[model samples]
Target: MTIQKTISLRPYPRGFHLITSIIEMQLAEIRQIKAGILHVFIQHTSAGLTINENADPTVRKDFETFINDLIPEGYAKFIHNYEGDDDMPAHIKSSFFGNSLQIPITDGKLNLGTWQGIYLCEFRNQGGPRNIILTAMGA
Candidate 1:
């Protein structure tokens, strides 16, 4: 079986937000596949998708802090300043974090680690709504 769909998320501030539940909620078709792989791709350039620690909010907070420090906004060297200081930095951050994820599906559920979860890394102060494309394939 195979299923695909695009999930839209509400706007969020610049931060790492846990969105595993949100994705699962939208892609209920995954449950029908006893074994498969779910491919998630973010359709925007300024944001990212990743899986990481989900038990503590501070992990997400620290992710934002460390990444910002690594690629601070308003860097004098940035040339793509058309959108604003955050624009170029957002692009850089997105590149580092990436825009997609592939997770194993077993027994009708995501086979993520016990402490793992999906995150939507919002790079802009107001990235507005984001779109995620989900593709599932299995027996």
Candidate 2:
């Protein structure tokens, strides 16, 4: 059987990045299903998903900085100006990363690393709500 869950996040900033309820969602799904694969998906183009360190806040901050450095804002080469300066940059970031992640499940629990955590990567600079989808397959 496969179970699905969705979570909504309200970001405070346009380009604000944050780790969301992926852990909780996975736990909840594990409680219902036993021994399976967990699939997490972000239903947005300007955002993405990744598994990273959850023990320290600095890890996330450093990742954000690295991504920003990799894709700086206010680039003159961007042709998509439909939203704003951060519009095309958001797309680039999404492309570089991803919109979904898959994790293994074991004995009704998510098989995550000691410091591993799932995060929602918001690239757009528009404070709003984002939706994340989590699906689990198993008995």
Candidate 3:
């Protein structure tokens, strides 16, 4: 069996946020898939998706710091400044982290590591509500 749904997340600040509960809450259909794969695709360029240590808030904060340092804003080298100083850097960060994730599903639940969780890497200061497409496929 296969199921797909588009989910929208509440607006978050410019940082990395854990959204595992939000996704599970909205995608209740995943409970029906005994064994399968869940593909999550974010629908935005200034923000992206990833999975990492969910048990530590510092990890998320460090992610933001590291990314910002790696792709600092106001470089004066980016031509896509129509949005703002964060525009170009946001796009670069999005590409670096990617916009999608594929996780294994077992026993009607995501087979994530004990400390792993999905993340929404909001690069822009006010990257409004983000959308994600969840597709689950299995028996």
Which candidate comes out best when scored by lDDT?
1
Instruction: Kindly list the per-residue Cα lDDT of model 1 for residues 9-94, writing each as its tens digit.
Output: 99989899999999889988888988999999999999999999999999998999999999999899999988888999999999
- Best-to-worst ranking by lDDT: 1, 3, 2
lDDT computed for candidate 1: 0.94
Return the lDDT, model 2, position 126.
Answer: 82
- Output the worst ten-in-a-row residue range by lDDT, candidate 1: 23-32
Error in Å for residue 131 of model 3: 0.6
TM-score: which is higher, 1 or 2? 1
Off by over 4 Å in 1: none
lDDT of 3 by residue, 30-128 (tens): 899899999999999999999999998999989988999999998977999898999999999999999999999998899999999999999999899
RMSD of each: 0.6, 2.2, 0.6
When 1 and 3 are scored with lDDT, the better candidate is 1
